[model samples]
Target chain A: MSTSFLHSFQSEWLKTRRSLAAWLVIIGGFFLPFIMLVGRTVYHEKTSAESTSPLFWENLAGQCWQFMALFLLPMGVILATSLITQIEFRNNAWKQVHTTPQHFYTLFWSKLMVIMVMVVQFFILFNIGIYLAGAVPALLLGTVDYPSQPFPFMYMLKTSGRFMLDILPVVGLQYLISLQFKNFFVPLGVGIAMLMLSLVMVEWKYGYIVPYTYSPYNFFELRGSAMSGSKDVNIHWLALSYFAFFTVLSFVLYISKKEKG
Target chain B: MHTIEAIGLTHHFSKEIPVLENIEMRVREGSIYGFLGPNGAGKTTTLRLMLGLLRKQGGEISIFGKPFEKHRTELLSNIGSLIESPTVYGHLTATENLTVWQKAYRCPKNRIPEALRLVGLHGTGIKKAHQFSLGMKQRLGIAAALLHQPSLLVLDEPTNGLDPGGIIEIREMLRNLNREEGVTILISSHLLPEIEKLATDVGIIHRGKMLFQGSLASLLLRQHQASRIAIETSDNAAALQLLAGNGLDPRIEAGCINLAAAEKPAIADINRKLVQHGLDVYRIATVEDDLETIFMNLTNQ
Candidate 1:
């Protein structure tokens, strides 16, 4: 079983080695931080504030990743899930892959694993983007007002680490969506729509039911509820619970469901 | 031993319209079993069910002498299939597409070349699958299916996009695969003439039901039984009246007079009698019933 799982994993990895979507994930990681750098530079050039604070780096790290939880990360998960599985659907390869000696469960889990690894790749590249965008401008201007001080490695790790834990359910949800729909754009459109709805839903008392909002609610609250000022979300328990629940549910349905040629 | 057997197989895409029902099919070992049908005859659906591509609601499929469900993965390792359309990775090159399946089936690396060569697509360099023509794409799909050297090959409309030469090439290859490699093949084709040339055993289906399942000889025998003699002249109506008056039992169909006869001698005698009566016989020939006619008789056509 392990050998079979490995084979499926290798097959998927090889398939996506030069994939455009995988490159998009890498490009997206750099997207937010670089934009932030451009924004801060414009802000400084337009209005050079007299007060210089060391906490500028701290605030930049906090705001960028918080924005990630709110928007970019969720979209990234959706794109990765959709793009990775699009190959199977586009080629109508589900039947071919399923009819092989490897079980669907193994292939299903391997897909989930590939998506997670890609998310991690984004996280690592995102951190690099933040560090360079923060330091490059600061080192040139020699200003303590902008993000110019020592890189906040620990702070960024703790913040993004919370995101990784909190977004597990979104991964599971998107995996199921990609496999269930034959149309390539359905999962992507649904994910984006769900994220938009989750933004509105987060204000309601039952917003915790929406997996898309978990990452934002968790990371902002990672400074603990006393400091961040949100009280209605169950961060770890719901995500982990959703992950475990959907993994089994999707597996059973996926195996029993007829694969389209 | 049979390579594949479907016992009372049935399927439906929707509750209102049944796709296939009570389909009993068997593919014997080491023979090319042609699943003959017209367009939308549920040929692809039945093949999908046998491969476990579709869920079987009310049936049992046994392959390699055991229940397909009980040992699906083990049984699948020996089966190779290309159903409905060609499946090729547009992002990858020709070689890379074969490599992907080669990894999945865990076949030897060298089999890739042999399969590629068999399909007449070797030595094409740096051409991604998206660049391939329709015929090239079909060839690549076949190469991938053969990459693993499967014991049974399930191909649905394998010659849909191929040129005449490519079609004949595939025919000869399938024949060689059956005769030399002893591979059991269950191929589906809507064209009766194409299947007639390649298949040893045939199963005719229409509107999702089995019409006939037997040998090629049996099909030919039915064709022989359907033979008739067509009498043509400048004035078909005159020839028709003449044949009818002479007790030849002629029926006018498609601008000619047709008489039911099992042999050429009867047709000649009719022609000679027509000439003797001063009725012009422009042409007189035995119309041996073709496989297409036999297929049309079996199905709605």
Candidate 2:
């Protein structure tokens, strides 16, 4: 049984690897953070006064992680979900899968694991690109004369990890939504709508509970600050709860119902 | 042992109407069984239920002496099926599609090329499935199903969109599989002649009911014994009078008399009697029971 499951998982992973959409997500994700780092470096090199600021490294880290949360993470989620589910829906291939020796849970999990792997790889590569891009410019410009704050690798890692953790709930929810609706636009449309609504609620001072609002909360908390004038919100607890809820919900939805081909 | 059996099978899409009502069918091992039905006759539904793709409302399905619902994964492992149109990934190459399904079934790697060769698609290298013709796609579907060397193969309308040559090739392939490999096959088709050529046993369905299920020879013999005699005479009135006078009232249609007869001598006797009655005997022949006639007779009744 384990061998069968592994074979199914490997086959699904191969399919995802060959997909054009997976390439787009990985390339676009790595590009976003790299672009932001380059923009910061050029702006600092062109203006010596801006380079003199002590908090420049912190600001760059802030921008890099924030850009990922806002744009790259959601884009990756949508791409991964659609890539995993669209082929099955378009070709009606689930009938073939259901008739095979592999169990339904095994089939479902193989696709889900492949999507999760894509997202995790994108997260790690994007952060590393951002770090290298930021570090090289600082070293090339001579840190002694520039006198900018030291780049905090640990803080960046911490913040990016938290940001990724916060997005886990939406990842699970988007996966469920993608499986529920075979069309690619519905999950994306719903994510964008919820994102815009969360933006409005964050300003209203009561939106900290929303998953999207946690994006900025994670960034600010990394800099040792709170966004809503309250330090009572436990970032670790919130991230853990979100991950648990979404994972459980996704499992329930997947295993409890009959999946038609 | 029976390769497939469904006892008192029932299915309904909703509470209002039943799609299949108390259906029962059996197919012997190492024989090709043809399921004949018209449009909306619950053929696809029956296949789905037998494959454990749908939940049975009531009844039991057994495959290779195992209950399908309880041992679904194990039973399905030994069965290869192509239920509807081939549900292959269009973006993947023919080889890639086979690889994916091969992994799903966990069959040995060597059987991949062997199955492809069996379907006459051995050398189409790295071409995406979308580029295949309708016939090639159907063959590819068959290749996917046969990859695991299953003991039983279930195909629903396998030759739906094939040309005559493609159809003949598939028919030959199926025959070879059954004869050479000893694989039991259950094929559903509305094409009577195609089924007549391939199937050893046949089951006819109408309006979600099994009208008849038996060997092809028995079905033909049953229909032949209840034979209809068509007699054409110059004086139709005199022939009708003579036929009814012999206690055999014939159905009259356009100067011809059609009536059922028990023996061949009765036909000869009717011809002799009509000739003796001063009527010119034009034609006297027994109508051989074709599938269409049998279908009409069974369904109309």
Give the range where candidate 1 chain B is weakest over 10 consecutive residues by summed lDDT: B261-270
What tens-digit string does per-residue lDDT give for candidate 1 at A219-244?
Answer: 55754542221364456788888987
Instruction: In model 1, state the lDDT of residue A69.
Output: 74
TM-scores for the candidates: 0.87, 0.90
Model 2: runs farther than 4 Å from truth?
A37-44, A47-61, A131-157, A223-225
Error of 2 at B15 (Å): 1.1
How many collisions between residues are there in candidate 1? Answer: 0
Error of 2 at B128 (Å): 2.1
Error of 1 at A10 (Å): 1.2
TM-score, structure 1 vs. true: 0.87
lDDT of 1 by residue, B53-110 (tens): 8888888999999899889889989989888778888888888888888878877889
**Model 1: per-residue Cα lDDT at residue A148:** 33
